[model samples]
Target: MDWNELAMELQKEVSGQVLTREPMARHTTWRVGGPADLLVIPDTIKDLSATFSFAADHALPVTVLGRGSNVLVRDGGIRGIVVKMFRGLTSMTIIGEDVVAEAGCYLPFLARAAAVHGLSGLEFAAGIPGTVGGAVVMNAGAHGDSMGDVLVQVEVMDSSGNLTRVPAGLLQLGYRTSRLMDTGETVVKVYLRLRRDEPVEIRKRMQANLARRRALQPLNMPNAGSVFKNPANASAGQLIDRCGAKGLTVGGAAVSEKHANFIVNKGRATATDIITLMEMVRRIVWDTFQVHLEPEIHIMGEG
Candidate 1:
C-alpha cells in the first residue's frame, strides 16, 4: 500500500495527531526543510508504541525528533514516519534528590522546574535549548557539566516497541554523542540525581550560565547553538575566528559575527544555505590549521 493508505489506517489505529506532507521547517529550530511523508505526535506511551508497531508492520523507516534544538532537517525532507514525543509527554516530578523528567521536557524548562524544587545539578543546563531526550542522545552540555553527570538512568522504548531502563554507564555518553542515536531507541523517561540547594542560589547559578551564553552566543539571531564541536582541548569558535571564517556568508546563511561557531539564518535562509556555509567553514578551517571541525548539530532527512 502507499503512504496515504498507511496514514488512513494509522488514523483509525492510534490516538495521536497525524499529518501527511508535514513541513519539516515548522518543527525544526533553524526553520528550514521540506516535508515529511508522515508526522505523528503521540499523546501517550501506548499511543507511541502503537504508532511504532504500525510503522514496523508497514516496513516504514522512522525518524524521532525531540525539541528540535540540535537538528538540521534537509530541504528534500524525510521519508516514512517522523515521530515526535511532545506535549502529552512533557511531565516532571521531584522525588527527594532525584527528578523524573519525561522525554519531551525541554532542557531549560526542566532546569527551572528543578530549581523551583531546590535542586542544583541542573543549573548548568538552564541555557541548553534542547529537550531531555535530545540532550541524552547528544550528551548535550555547556561550561564544565553535562547531562551524563546527573543522569541516573534512562527509560527508552526499542524499535520493537519494548521498553527498557538502561543505566548511565551503559549509555556511552562522550563529548556530544551517545549510543541512543546509533541504536535508534526512543527516550521516554529520565531519572536525574540532583543536590538540595537554596532555590535562590540555584537560580543565581542558572542566571550566570545564561548571561555567559548571551555574551558568547548569537542569541538575537535564528540559529542552532553551535555548528561545530570543539576538537580535543581547543575551542571551535576560537579556531573558526582564527581562520577568519566569521562573517562568511553562503546564500542567506552566515557565520555569526558575534560567535564564529554559530551560523545564523539571515531571514530567508534555506537548509541548503546552512549546509553550504557549514561545509565552507569546515574546508577553510581544515586548510588553515589542519584541524577538521566536527559538526555538533544532527543533520537529518534525505539528500
Candidate 2:
C-alpha cells in the first residue's frame, strides 16, 4: 500500500530500472523539469506490459515518456509512476519491404536504417530527435512528410496492459496530430511501409534534410524543436519574426533568433520563464497578424 512496497514489488516483476524521486529535468529536451515521484524504464514490451498491469491493479497514476523531445515539465514535478520506454524496447527488423521497429528506437536511427535498406520515405526523420512511439503519437514530420505517410500498423498497449495491433486508418492522424495524442495507450511497436529506392539517392536526401535542420535550428541550445505549429499556410517563425519578437527573453528562456518558433534555455531556465515567453510571443503574433498560435511541445507537471 505504501510507495516503497509498490516500488519493491515493481522491481521484482519488471525487468528494468526503477528510481524514486527522479529528476524529470534530466529526462526532457528543454532540460528543465521537477522530479518524478517514481520513474520506471522497461526494456521490452513484456516488461512494459507488466509495469502497466501493476499500475492498473494498484490504482497508481501512470505517465508514458518516449525520448522527451517535444515536452516541457514544470517545477513542481510529476506525481505517480512515470514509465519511459528505451533501450530494451529498441529493436528494428526489416520485414520484406516494411520495417518493424520498437517504440524506443530513435527516429533518426530508423531513418538511417531505412536508407541502409534502400527504403525510401523516412528521409524526413533523419535529424528528428524523437522516438518511433512519440512520432506516431504526434504525427511528427518535416519537409512535407510525416509518420502517418508511411505508417501501416502499430502495436499499442492499453491502460489495462493489453497489447493490440491497430491499422493506420484507426489512428486518425493529421498534420502533427493524432488520436493517440490524448489516448492513454502506449505505443509498443510501429510498422512502416516504404518504397524501394537507390540507397545513394536515399542517403543524399537524408543528408540534405540534416543539413537544412542544422542550418535552421539552434541545435547547439537546449530547446524543444518547434514551440508552435504552423498556422494555416503561414509559418509560425515568419509571423514571430515579423512581430519583432525574436530574441525576446524572460528569465533564462529566450526565443531563438536562429528560428523564432523555437525558445531556447540560455542555461538554468525555469519552466515559468519559458511559459511566460511563449505567452508573450502568442499575444504579439495574435495582435499583429490576427493568427492564433498553438504550442507543438507538450507542457506537463505544475509550477
Candidate 3:
C-alpha cells in the first residue's frame, strides 16, 4: 500500500510523528507484536483529526489505541493507520465537584488526582492500568465500580473526524462493553462527577485498593490483565483455578499462578502463545463447568 509514501503524506498533513512499519510491541503492555504498516502519534486534537482525515482521503483502515493495556496486538500487527492517543491528550482539570480529563490521561493518575482534590468516586480506579479513553470505551472497572458509575459525558471523534459531545447514558455501558466499541468512535475527553470527601479518607481507600491489586494480580509480569470475563454470577478466575488451569503453559505464555484470570508472558512470548493458552484455558473451564468463558481483553490485528 506504499506505507512509506502514505507516512510522508500524513506527516505533511498533520503536526504529529508519522512512521511506517513501526513496531507494535513497543506500544502494547504485553510487549509482543509485529510492525504496524503506519503509525501516528498525534500532538493535539487537530493533529488527530487531520490524521483521521488523511486516512479517510486514502480510503485506509484506522485503529486507535491508548496506554495499550487490556489489549493484545497480534504478531502480524495491524494494517492501515494506527493512531496512538496516549502522551498527547493527557490534560485534566478539577471543576467544583467534577473532574474533566482528556482521553489519554492515565486512569491511575486520574484516580490519584481525584483523591488529592478530595473527591470520592474514583478510588476503585487506582489500580487499573489503562487510559481514560480505553476505560470509558470498555466500561472498565474494579471493586464493583465501573466507569459508567461516574461518567457524566464524553467528547468523541467520529471516523470521519467529526467531534461530538455524548452523554454517559447514550454510551450503553454494561459489563465491560460500550456503544463506542461498536461505533468505532474515538473518545477525546471525559467528564466525571464525583462527590466531595475527606482527602485523607479518599487516599486511604485508594491505598487499600492498590494493596489488594498488588496482592492478587501478577503486576510484575507482562500481561494484558484478565483474560476472561466472569460469567453471570461466577468468577472466571475461580472457575479456571478449579479446572486446574493455573501454571498451564504454551511456549512463553502461561496462566498466572498468582491470578488464574491472567496469562503472563514469562519471556519471549508471542501473540500466538497467548492466544493458544487462552483457548486452552477456555476449553478446560468450559468442559468442567459448562460455562463459556468470554475474553475480557481486546484482541487486535491479524494472526
Off by over 4 Å in 1: 1-4
Question: Highest TM-score among the candidates is held by which one?
Answer: 3
lDDT of all predictions: 0.89, 0.90, 0.92
Q: Every model's Cα RMSD, please?
A: 1.2, 1.2, 0.9
Better of 1 and 2 by lDDT: 2
The digit string of per-residue lDDT tens for model 3 on 1-303 reads 888888888899887789899989899888888888999988889999998888889888999999888889999999999998888889999988989999989999999988898999999899888999999999999898999999999999998889999999999999999999999999999999999999999999899989999999998999888889999999999999999889999999999999999999898999999999989998898789899999999999999
Q: How close is candidate 2 to the true structure, as a TM-score?
A: 0.97
Across 13-90, the per-residue lDDT of candidate 2 in tens digits comes to 888988788898899889999988779999877788888888778778889999888999988888888888766589
True lDDT of residue 13, candidate 3: 81
Residue 9: error of model 3 in Å?
Answer: 1.8
Give one digit per residue, the lDDT tens place, for model 1 in 13-106.
Answer: 7788888989988887788888999999887888789888988888889899987778899989999999986665788898899889889888
